[model samples]
Target: MATLTHRRIPGRVRDMPSDFPQVPVQDNETSLDGPREAKAFLYKFSQAVEESDWKSFEGLFAEQCWWKDHLTLTFDKRTIQGRQGISSAWQSLAPQRKPRGFSIAGPGIEMVETPPAFVRMTPQMATLDIPFAFSVSRPDCACVGIAKAIPSASSWKIWVLTTSVVSLKEYPFQPLPRAVTSNDLISPEQRGKATPQGLPHFQEALDAVVIGGGCSGLSNLIMLDSIGANVACFDLGSPGEAWLQRYRSVRLHHPNFMIQLPKYPVPADIASTHLNGAELAQYMSRAVQDLKLPLFAGVKVTSNVFDQERRLWTVSLEEVQSGQTSTVQTRNIIISHGFYFNEDCPVIPEGLKDRGKFSGPVQHTTQFSTTDLYEGKRTVIVGSGNSAHDIAKFLGDNAAVQSVTMLQRSPTAVFDFDTFHPFITALYQGNIPVDTADFLFSQLPLGILRDWMGGAIAELVKSSEKLYSKLEAKGYLIDRKPNFIQRVYEDRVRSIYFDAAGAFDLVLRDRIKIAHGTVVGFTENGLIVKDAETEAERILEADGVVLATGYAKTDLPKQWAKSGFLDAESALQIENMGMPAVDVEGEMIGQVTRSGHPQLYFSGYIFSAARSFSRFVAIQIMADINGQAPEHGLP
Candidate 1:
């Protein structure tokens, strides 16, 4: 790699406060690497903080620096800009004045290549833990601090600092107290025979039974098995079957680091940067085998019934191939079926209801196999989310396809993936570990985080003004309000697309036509779409129509009730709990609901960027089963 030198422009220097403590300057022209300099700087900085030497602490920062406080040290989020601002903020929010004294501990320092920067220090701190019943009330609780600095003429001057707290139990990568012995390395049969003293052994009646064998379900199984719980997992198909069934071209939208599974991460050799569907399935398969989880594959869960008197769930299972039936009783049941449990295809318009009337075939996005099916023909794709955009681009670029048109009901919030690559790299790459980045990113409150993201979106739109203008010129509608994250959280649907692919460029160049309308009815050739602006109906010519309008909310609780898996009252209780039942503490709302359904739990329902949220769900489930659930009201 070539080294780039950064020229520092001369700037005005602020005078030190008269009351601040003065320290002797270190040697100016010493030769030290980034890590060495960072460690030396932290030593002085920590000493200054411990002694309450505000002047020495303030002197270490550059004239223009930023200090960001996540939810760890401060109850509210803050970004203090400039040396003066940072000094004032720290003075006002002095740690010594608070009930607990703050101290820096276990700092990990690394070098950054860009901006001619040298050291980036990430230190772990010890402080009072959050006042949750499940939390350990230790004086030395773990937290994280990040500091960045550049080599100045005199010495290394700090430029940016950030801090946040981490949950030991929630983060799966963190080591647990349990000791793994040689027996833990034994075969599944031997391990099953040697049970923990308190926990029940694996048998027909299990302590817990998790449904689904995909990423989410597998995550739960890993956590449960780690705690020596006699747990069993069942799925309709094989492990990672959903990913195997996806289109061949489908790669994970997020980077590999973001999609990693807790406890069992994707191996470094297997495309550590990004993973296709098949690759992800392969990783999950290995994880299932390595964990020695009791997984019943190719088994369909026919029904689940809760026995009120026994406080146990009796689940009816059937072998898909042989049609053989069996049953199992478990104390706790976790419905880990993912959000996309069923495909939702809109009813065919009244005009095209008759098969004889329409020549072309109409199908849902799920039924779509490959582009070869629509070769040398025109195709219309409905909706404007990621899937719709991907399908439109695929059809448009196909050599045989005559043309591709996208029918979007409303404007979509689209931004180039490159626009956020720097941010993503900073969070997931370099000195900071992905898990630490995840913890810090989740520290801010939702409302505050949304406001910050909204600002970022505005700046991004301004930066890509010309590209957006081209999109607008080509009749594409863009929505900027609420930002992407807010929209995803509010509506379960993913309404934004990260333009890592060439979909945006295709739309701009008219390779794919964008039609802003709603399908009121359908015609034989294509479909009749009503324009949003003019309210005029137009006929679009196409050989087939793909409905990418997203999945229907079948109400899992209601379906479970109808199947006799849960009582009508319990189902209603879960239904009223809303999607995922997330509380303010970021825990699922009903780990132990007000009704106290101890054996009932849910997973794979929350919308979070960090795939590790599944791990937190598993932790809460384990806590609940072990009678360690926090005794608090719903957040």
Candidate 2:
């Protein structure tokens, strides 16, 4: 909250044209003693802290540096941005937290899977990245940190340092034994429904209330339960309803092996190349039920008030079908409503130039279930986004439809699955363990990752050039944001169409046409649209229009204010809460889990973050409620 800033990493800048190898390489791999030197640097760092030598500790960092701490010393995921901030944090929180026994995380030079420490070059800078592990003894926790160093004054000076609390010592997330007997998996029988012990309805107060029973909320519940915190999730529909209600052709592109909830792998029997939305929903619901996770199905939060005196929230809930209302109490609230949600109705467009002259049916993507309903009907999809393309594919593939066209307001970045697979899919696919894949990604902060991702994306785009060239030749406009990571910042999900050859093949084959224009007005049986590039106005005849323009971001603060869910102080604490943390240049640096208010955590995250890092969110809430991480936690 103090300042929003940017510090460009020194090297072959991504998003800029460069002939040098995109992969940062050490000047001399054989000559570099990276592991030994990095270990020595870490030793000095530990010694300085142990001796309470503030000057020596300050000297360990570069002038421009960052320290991202995730509940290690600070209960919040905070980025201390400078040497001053870093030194001040260490001075204030170190003695009390008592972090010690620092050592290299793994077999530094020999290991390949766990991402060992190394030295790499950027043409201008030689950087040493060392991943280390340490023990936090005050409350008893296991933590890890990675320090990026550059040689300055003939010594390695760290520029970026990340310290994360992996887990608490008492409530350890022990992995199930690799070789186990049938007796190890057996469990005692439960009484009524298979659900975690908590308020079945709105019968009693709770420690945590997770709104949105989808993956995000469910994942958070798992973590909260692991930490021994009483938590429950609420959804507007029954489990898997959100996914099952999506259009019939909805299928996820993510690798199935990497998409499972924590400690709950998708069943082997239902595995496929692409996970169907309905299948995923069923699996998630079944997983929750089997795990005994508490979920209040078919219920939604109507309103709530945060009690400052009691440090609790009294939430109003209503059953969708029964029209029954109830109140539940909670000390902490996590709004894990997720990035993409299924709404009962589509987003009604507000400002169409014409007033009620169109005779054609207008449907939102949410309302369109099947192409069978529009037999022999001409359809115009209003957006060139992922949903628009999917709808176009369905209409084009259906033999009954006369024609299907996509009216684009702006150029869309589309990459076929084969080309885009290497960057995202390949990482998760091969024999690499899921944890190792995740650990490799967790090694660097997103900002630095963005710098490197541009290179990988650039290489992939070379293979996708033909795909783009052919589309542009067919009148479809295309644009590529420098880094795909920025897409996550702007869209919360991958906005670029990972064209899976169904809709894309149709478009390229001319079965489905693409138009570059905006719908300005409507005709009696069609739409009057304006060309984006030129001032030409045109008419697209259609029997119906599907608004795949997507929905607006949820303004939770406004809704909360209107419904008295938060006080002025807490409202300000969480003001502008949900969104990835970005630098001044608008490059996403990190994902935010804090709202300035420690107890009121926001976990409305992307799919991967929601599934992988929900534990971090849960532990923070646990810290707040149990006083492990205070409201005014470490800086």
Candidate whose lDDT is highest: 2
For all candidates in order, the CA lDDT equals 0.56, 0.66
* Model 1 segments more than 4 A misplaced: 1-204, 340-356, 576-596, 605-612, 633-635
TM-score of candidate 1 to 2 decimals: 0.70
Listed in order, each prediction's TM-score against the native is: 0.70, 0.84
Which portions of model 2 show Cα errors greater than 4 Å? 1-28, 31-38, 62-64, 82-84, 107-115, 119-128, 150-155, 174-204, 339-357, 430-436, 481-483, 493-495, 563-573, 577-593, 596-598, 631-635
Clash number for every model? 2, 0
Candidate 2 lDDT over residue span 1-635, tens digit each: 11112222222223322122123444555587778888889999989988889899999998777776666776545556668878888888877788888877654311123433554544444567777888776567877777778776567888878777777776665342122233221122221122223224435567788888777788787777656666677777666676777778888777677677776777888867667878887787777666766677777788657776877788787877777777888887787775334253245555453436776667788888888766777888888878888778878888898888898887777778777766676557746656545655555555566666776677677877877788888888777555566666655443468776378788878889987777877787788888777879888888877888776556545555765656555665563533334544232333334354545666655556665467777665655555555333452
Best by TM-score: 2
